[model samples]
Target: MPRAEFDKPVKVLIVASPYYKDISDNQIAGAVAELDAVGAGHDIVHVPGALEIPTAIGIAERLSNFDGYVALGCVIRGETTHYDTVCNDSSRALQLLGLQGLCIGNGILTVENYAQAAVRADPKDQNKGGGAAAAALHLIALTRKWGNSGQSVGFASDILLAGGKTTA
Candidate 1:
């Protein structure tokens, strides 16, 4: 995978839910390794479950100086529809945050059983946690690229060219 390069120092916040201790640990290890490889600074925070990962990240974005976030957790399917709810809602919340321009990497795993989660969470295997961290870093790099500019871009510039025409 192509890793994002940075000009300035980057800092990331890792929000991990250790509901499944074994899986969560491996995921965190992968995430940390990826961040370290790029010399990105990071801090880790734990939540009780996957559902809370987004909320914790939101809080950090609002109050902390983090450049990005990595969300890590595992949700194994069972007899109840609760698995669907947790997986969908947590993912949706992260997406919403991302839409709002928050640099976030969602590493949450929604799988059929322990075996599936194990494979994906393994640092030496799928390394999805590392993938998620990379996603966040790329977003942070993009943010730095665009946010440093002094002028507006895309549609706004087009509107100005059109003599202040309003889309609405």
Candidate 2:
């Protein structure tokens, strides 16, 4: 069994969006494989759709012991604005968690149509879940480093150092 030894072992919650069960399943499977590669401890939870991801995330955050989170979902665009709402809201929520050093990896997909969704939903060609898991690992590393830093660093400062720059 692969195992990772962290300065502080983190409990992670994988909140999967159940909107598109098939896609979500693929996402979860990939996420699990990635997590297994890192040998990190994790639990899986299911939500109705992308909209509910944040609520689940909030629960994980409040647990106060988890080192990070991974959000997995698929939202194929429809004729309505529903797609926009779910995608934006879910992304923002994860960003908020990241800002708080919650170390969340998001694998939610906003596709133009079912065909495109299907393409990215493939476990082989589309490994967004794995990408998200890797992101979580990096975030965990960053958080551990910043927490131990003697110098006080703000959230924006951390983001900037993490190779993120604001475009204005």
Candidate 3:
């Protein structure tokens, strides 16, 4: 996997849901290792479940100065429809936040069973947690590439004024 290189160390926040303690621990381990390898500093914050991961990151984004966020959790299918609700809603929330220009990586696992969750969360296996961290780093790199130009899309102020149009 291609990774972004940085001359200065970046800071990241890992928001994890510890509903499944062992699984969450493993995922956290993988994410931490990846951040360490890239010399990025990180801090971990635990929430109750998958749905809370994005909320925590949103709070941190407003209150802290993290360069990016890694969201980690596991949602296993159960006998009820609650599973679907949790999976879809959590994913959607993360996607929405990303669209709003927040650098967030969704690592929450939505699987049919515990076995499937284990394999994906394991650092020695798919290492999805680490992959999430990498995703956030890549986004941070892109944000840095653009810097803060404060330019907006659409017609320039002068053009809008000429047409007797105003932007409110």
Cα shift from native, residue 67, model 2 (Å) = 0.8
Q: Estimate each model's TM-score.
A: 0.89, 0.80, 0.88
Q: What does candidate 3's lDDT look like per residue over 61-115, in tens digits?
A: 8999999999999999999999999999999999999999999888999999999
lDDT of each structure? 0.94, 0.78, 0.92
Per TM-score, the best of the predicted structures is: 1
How far is 91's C-alpha from truth in model 3 (Å)? 0.5
Model 1 C-alpha lDDT per residue in residues 28-103, reported as the tens digit of each score: 9999999998999999999999999999999998898999999999999999999999999999999999999999
Going through the candidates in the order shown, the clash numbers are 0, 0, 0
Q: Best candidate per lDDT, number?
A: 1
- Model 1: residue 99 alpha-carbon error in angstroms: 0.4
Off by over 4 Å in 2: 1-8, 150-168
Off by over 4 Å in 1: 150-168
Q: Weakest 10 consecutive residues, lDDT, candidate 3?
A: 153-162
Residue 76 displacement (Å), model 2: 0.8
